[model samples]
Target chain A: MSTKTTRTQDILDRTPSSIALYRLLVPFVIVGLWELLSRWIGPRVLPGPVHTFSALYEGIQSGWVIPNTNVTMQAVVISFLIATVIGGVTGLILGFNKPAYDIVEPFFLSFYSVPKITMYPIFLFIFGVGLNTKVGFATFSSFFPMLIITMGAVRSIDDVYINVGKSLQVSRYQMFRHIVLPYILVQLVVALRLTFNSAFLAVILVELFAARSGLGLVLQHAMGTFNSEEILIVVTVLAVIAFVINIIFYGAQQLLEERWNMTSDEQMGI
Target chain B: MSLTGLSSLPYSKQIRLGRATLLVAILATLELVGRAEWFDQLTYVPLSTMVETAYGLLVSGELTDDIITTIGLVFVSFVSATLVALVIGWFLWRHDKVKQVLDPYLIVLYAMPIFVFYPMFIIVFGLNVFPIVLIAFAMSVTIIIISTANGLAKVPDVLIDVGRSMGLSRREQFRHVIFPAAVPYIFTGLKLGFVYAFIGVIASEFILSNSGLGYQISWYYQQFQTADMYAVLLIVITLAVVVNLGLIRIEDRLHRRT
Candidate 1:
């Protein structure tokens, strides 16, 4: 009580180590509280952080991570590719064709607003509860953003660039390769990053709904059996994977943008 | 003047007509194909069948109840998440150190499949609306926080100086200068946060719970009632469109007022 510190003074006095200490302090408090609560409630009702972490480690050691993670990754990657390709081409067509865009743009806007997972049952019925359905779900869920972003990118390319191509009397293919492709590539990369996240979530959702194997399946089984430790472990692993993938995409996007000498702010009129 | 009228009025009319025609064309084609049995049972269902099933569900009041449940969850979660985000965002703006340390983690939170935390939330809150609300809140709060902080930061130093020169206190300056300046960004955050909350609740209902439109979807799909499932899906899409359009109108009004 005698050694009271002012808020401004405390803030000004914070060094790097103190800042780090403060950062750790929140989680430490949270975990401490969790552990205490868990003890009071017992492990069956609520496992402590230590129990959950150890179980996660044991899960990794027991070869539970590989097959399920591989399945998820496969679905995510493949669906991302499909969404990008289809969405990109469709975006190009709509971006160029004003009439076509007018006809379809409103529908796409509505579709984008809706939770796309509602369409999953349709995909499930069509593709069955297999790789096809999962991939289809991932593709459907992820593609709209890609489509919208790509169309924006295409439409936003300065008229000057196309004028130069026209002045040189270049073929359509040549104009696209020389002018449009480079201009839109950076935007495509941004779209890819977003699509990856959506596709990954879609895979998890589909797996949770109906799947024989995957991280979503793991979570589903755990929740069903009331295996909180297993559920926590799988959830942690999925979060880490998502984090790592996002970092990689962010780094690559930055590098690509730098090489292209374009900032997203300048390009993203949309 | 005629050209202007044509471009402003008839042009928009033409576009709307074209959109309607395209929709009708697609629906008619699907109806034809469905009736003809040109595709497999899983692949095609007639528009008439879907409409009939939707009407049946509506008449029975089952669809209305489910819609109310889902929308109720979404609204509660969205509002709470926005409130929490505003408080945290204001605090973060007050403390630079915490903001800097937590920046990357917030990005991680937004990027990841936060629904994975649903199980843990379920354990904490038990198997009811609480877990679903928590799931929506977790998914959306980060987005609102980032946007709110960005908005607050965007309040110009010159504006604050002006407020001070006008003999305004700190709180008065914030209220008059900073808060108004940040309204656009805050609005954006609220809009996006609501979307995330909607998606989170629906997805959670699909996976975790048993009494919303999402649950109906899962239940119908499981029971092989494809037409009813499609009807529910259609209702959801319509709701999204209507809600979004309503929000757009409100946003426009807000912009005009500001």
Candidate 2:
């Protein structure tokens, strides 16, 4: 049995690293093949990696990319922050109080199902074709998922934990701070990741629809002018930024989950 | 602990009543403020006017045609995306090396806003439904791949071993065990894919198309026809809600079967 278990463990250990290396290799090969094909096909049909890289570098060096990217990121950050605070507070209220949940939960479900991009024109009319419109959409987009996740997280906490706090003569505030907060912290991280994802989509959608300045604007202009190189550069940068953000958030989630698991295990004497 | 209400009504009924009251209150407030012209500078048309205009638009063939076009685009894109994702996901499941190598790319693709590729798509496919479909497909494919792959990865080793012990062919085992287990995950992917595809289709319409609800909304915006724009917006929102509820029902049915 011990030997069998060891063999299984060995297989598991070997699989992940080999998989990682292969994952790394696939992109390089694809990029290389793409470069070769582009070179063979000519710039009109396809621009080579070198040309695209140069264009991207030039755009960055000339400060053409920075301003738009900055504006987009600003909208994303501000909207995400606002969504987080509002969603968190509302979620807590609903989760903790049955009356509030009963009153507001159905409304959230109905609105959450709606495709927000459909409302872009209304938002444009209300806030005009500006940063506020973009940010408003982003906030709206991020709010629902965060609110839902928070409610779920809060609701999932064992009643025993709350009872324990009460038994210890903990004040309502103390109960929330000591037990409720920590219980929801891990879930909050999950909600934050989701909120960020939604916010990113919201920003992109809004920018694509009507934006005077942003990466979307840059792409729109490039398309209009047939500036393939510039478009590729902007796209590559956005992809990289998105990739980095996802990786960071994923890592953070894993770390938080591990810590929470450890603490919970200790409490349970497991 | 206090789940049993003092009132004669069941807890669910009370909850429903509370929800209904809140909805009514919100709608009333919105109607009052809208009709009162509290935000006249912001919107020239009130909510009531917007609804009337929306009803008129619904009667017109314009709204129907746009809805049909958008739905067609969404359906086509979703089907293609799901097919592509299934093939890719299966390939990754079979080959450890390929799966590893493609994981980062997949992650990057998943995170990256594929909407940015609209220009490239247009350059390749032009300003037609083809480009819109491609955009929607790109938007949805990543979610499908992720969910499908995750689903496959989550299959129990014991189940595989049991199948092997039972002398089941690999293909048979995959069809019967792996596929069934992955249904829920695939449905999850489908749900997300549909939502994204809906958004992508609308976004594409907004960016380039001369027709469709998105185009209509944009046209109304350009004309400063606030009531018409709001009407279009309401229609879009209502359609989305209906589609979402439909998907949810499908998901629930599938879950029950599994």
For each candidate, report its DockQ versus the true two-chain complex: 0.47, 0.45
Against the hidden true structure, what lDDT does model 1 obtain? 0.79
* Docking band of candidate 1: acceptable
RMSD of 1: 6.2
Query: In model 1 chain A, where is the ten-residue run with the lowest total lDDT?
Result: A1-10
Off by over 4 Å in 2: A1-16, A33-42, A171-178, A259-270, B1-6, B41-44, B95-108, B155-168, B256-258
TM-score of each: 0.84, 0.86
lDDT of 1 by residue, A90-193 (tens): 99989877766767876775567688887887776666789988998899899987897788778778999999999999999999998998888877777777
- In the order shown, the chain A TM-scores of the predictions are 0.79, 0.82
Candidate that would win on DockQ = 1
Clashes of each: 0, 3
List residue ranges in candidate 1 displaced over 4 A. Answer: A1-42, A164-186, A254-261, A265-270, B1-14, B39-44, B156-165, B249-258
Q: Identify the candidate with maximal TM-score.
A: 2
